[model samples]
Target: MSHLRIVRDEPPKRRERRPHVNHVLTHAEQAQARAALKGLRNAFGSWSALAAAMDVRITTLMAAARGAYNVSAALLVRASRASGLSIGDLLGKPIAADRCRACGQIKRRVA
Candidate 1:
């Protein structure tokens, strides 16, 4: 039998760890934001498309989602309309009735 050739693989390099930024929100907040993003995406497809339709920059919504900025209740309402969702849905809050507050009609998420 021929002598076996020995080859040792190098260990993988450890990734450089960066210091955590204080501006980032806690895990819980990130979860909520992620949920909100899911709801929004379900409604409007993508943030970029939704922003284009709403005439707002995508970065604005991104900033809000990442906790780098805050959006007002009114802006949230507008975004809700733009995304074909309700404010409660966008915020991951459940509406008690799931009915239209305007006309008392049964309503779905988008319509």
Candidate 2:
């Protein structure tokens, strides 16, 4: 009788992963986003109207207004356009230095 030999393949090595980072909005930013959405809702006089204006579902707008979920950047841009406010204002940041000339600090460019 002859003894049988078996060959097995080695397992692949695992890759290293970097530590996770928390990118969720802070409490204050969440509140600001919620307030901005709510104000838009109020302006439109109904959730459905606001949703139509934003082209999002009424439930989504409601949840965002109630702070049930983090408001996305695209949603914020829609709100900004409908409200005539800049994205910076929606995010509670001052407008970019170049676009804001009302402060009288930015000099006019000579063309």
Candidate 3:
């Protein structure tokens, strides 16, 4: 006589958590990021190229450049190293400025 055996399936494993996702940048910071992205994009000719050179994702680079989200510091270092530029140069200079009535603060454009 032969005996029959039953087997049970295991549950799927959960993915490890990444850094805090939804950490949006401030208005001024967004401006700076966009400006910096412009220069980096120019150098690489495209967001994909830049991200590829930095070993990161194109979407991440695009979002960071468009000010849609903040970039990781490690990515920043990678960009700077890959471009042979300092952090200051990557984050281009400001272009315009205006006073805020609500907070009585001055905001400047980053070019």
In terms of lDDT, model 2 sits at 0.73
Off by over 4 Å in 2: 1-24, 93-111
Per-model TM values vs. the true structure: 0.45, 0.58, 0.55
Give the count of colliding residue pairs in each prediction: 0, 0, 1
Winner by TM-score between candidate 3 and candidate 1: 3
Give residue 59's lDDT in candidate 2 (0 to 100).
94
* Candidate 3 per-residue C-alpha lDDT over 5-110 given as tens digits, one digit per residue, 9 for 90 to 100: 7765986688998878544445565577677666677657788888888888888888877767676566667877877767665555632224332354766659
For model 2, what is the error of residue 94's alpha carbon versus the real structure, in angstroms, after optimal superposition?
13
**TM-score, candidate number 2:** 0.58
Cα lDDT tens digits, model 1, 1-111, are 789877769866899999755444455545554466545554567888767766677888777666676554544666667757665555554333445545658777665
Candidate closest to the true structure, highest TM-score: 2
Query: Candidate 3: how large is its RMSD?
Result: 9.7
Task: Show pairs that collide, candidate 1.
Answer: none
RMSD of each: 12.1, 11.2, 9.7
Off by over 4 Å in 1: 1-34, 92-111
Higher-lDDT candidate of 2 and 3: 2
In candidate 2, list every pair of residues with a backbone clash: none
- Write model 2 residue lDDT over 1-106, tens digit each, in one string: 9999776697667899987543566777777878778766766788898888888999988998897767876788888887677866776743333344246365
- Return the candidate ranking by lDDT, descending: 2, 3, 1
